[model samples]
Target: MTRILCIGEAMVELSAQGDLWRAGIAGDTLNTAWYLRRLLGPSHHVGYLTRVGRGDFSRRAVDFMAAEGIDTSHVTTDPTREIGLYAITLTEGERSFTYWRDTSAARGLADGPDRLQSALVGCDIAYLSGITLAILPDAGRAALLDALRGRDVVFDPNLRPRLWPDAGRMRAAITEAAGLAALVLPSFDDEAAHFGDADPKATIARYRAAGAGQVVVKNGGGPVAYGGPEGSGVVDDLPRDRPVDSTAAGDSFNAAYLAARLEGGTCADAIRAGHALSRRVIAHPGALVRAAV
Candidate 1:
């Protein structure tokens, strides 16, 4: 089996549903792993690596991953801290979040080099995000990057400014992480706002220049720009009505694109597949939607 490991946090998610609140388990890397598990056949072994508390929420998160066929053997338990929680508020299909993760156990996920090396033992593809870096301590981030060096790493610069102490450090850390990734998937809006990328092409250029083997820039419902050694091109995203909740659109797209590419599809084919899955994800509420492509 081809082992694919996603390294990051899984939070207790709370999404506002009218008067009531809906609770579930989700996070950026976990979201991609979920969709990847659903898209890929049984031959692909998907595993999650992170630290969680011994609390009920943390136990539920691990149970949820197991229920979804994701291997949870690398999930470590910490007695001092519990899992993080975030609540989503939606306005006209746009989503914003308020997080309670200051003391999250995932902050120590990359604390040890031995654990990081063990989790990557036979990992064919290892996935991570800027949020993962932001949540980690300096030494932990360094350890993670060192362990991931020379590996087939896929990175999403899912910039969350609030998670970082300052903008300069965030940018530097993301660029450093991008250099370690074989493929860099970045959303145009986030790159534009934080990195001053003029367009999707600029976003692709920046990551490519940062030593990313390939770069794909996601532009909401707009055209996607991609470039790499294999090839480069633009693929127009399918036009659709306003979404129900835009949470995890880019995450789902990453999963679909990577899954297709792993199955030997071309870059253009992968982009189209990504778009198809992303459109379906935004058509529903929450991050882990029931999507097929």
Candidate 2:
């Protein structure tokens, strides 16, 4: 079995269901971990690394992960810090976020002993996102990077500019993280804002130079580009006529792509899997849809 260690924040998510509001747990890495475990089933061991508070919501999040068959043994608990939350408003199938995560427990994940280290060392892959980088303090970030040095890291620069302190700091952190990752999955819009790339080719070049062996740049409504051991090429063009919500498109893409690769699917096959999953996700309301797996 391939063990995957996913590190990030899992927060209470409040989304609207018609006139009523529904509460659930959601985060970038958490969402990926859920889908990855679902896709891989019992063959892959998926463990999540984060911090949660001693509250009902935190407990509920753990219960949710357990129900999904994601291992939460490595999740640290803090009594002081509370669980974070974000509200989502959907309009015409499009979603926008409003956060209340100033003192999220996940921010303090690296403060304790090397417990997380043992879990990570046992994993075949370590996956995280840019939001994971933003929430951590300098010391925590340093500790995380150090621990991840010898692992097969999968990074999705799921850039949330509002979560970052500044553009320069975000770039520096992303550059450092990209260098450590074996595979980098970056969205074109985020890359354009961070690196000022004129197009996907330029963005792929920038990330490739940073030492990523596999680079997959997803362009919204445009062709996806890849530069890897199998050689560089455009994976596929997006559907022109489909209406998309576009919230979890990239996250679902990352999951399907990684799952395909881990299942021994070719690069082109993986990209197709990514696109197929993403198209379905964006056609729905939130990050996940109620379709048959």
Candidate 1 lDDT over 120-228, as tens digits, reads: 9999999999999999999999999999999999999999999999999999999999998889999999999999988888888888888998998888878888898
- After superposition, the stretches of candidate 1 with alpha carbons farther than 4 Å from their true spots are 291-293
Q: Best candidate, lDDT-wise?
A: 1
In candidate 2, what are the lDDT values of residues 1-293, reduced to their tens digit?
89998999999888777788888888989888877887886788999999999999999998998888899998889989988999888666566899999899999987754876776777999999999999999889888888889789999988888888898888989888988889999999888887899988887788778877788888775688888766889966556425346667777888899999989998778888888887777776666564714
Worst window of 10 by summed lDDT in candidate 1? 234-243
Q: Best by TM-score, which number? A: 1
| Residue runs of model 2 more than 4 Å from their true location after superposition | 240-244
CA lDDT, every model vs. true structure: 0.93, 0.84
Q: How close is every model to the real structure, measured as TM-score? A: 0.98, 0.95
Q: Which ten residues in a row have the lowest lDDT in candidate 2?
A: 237-246
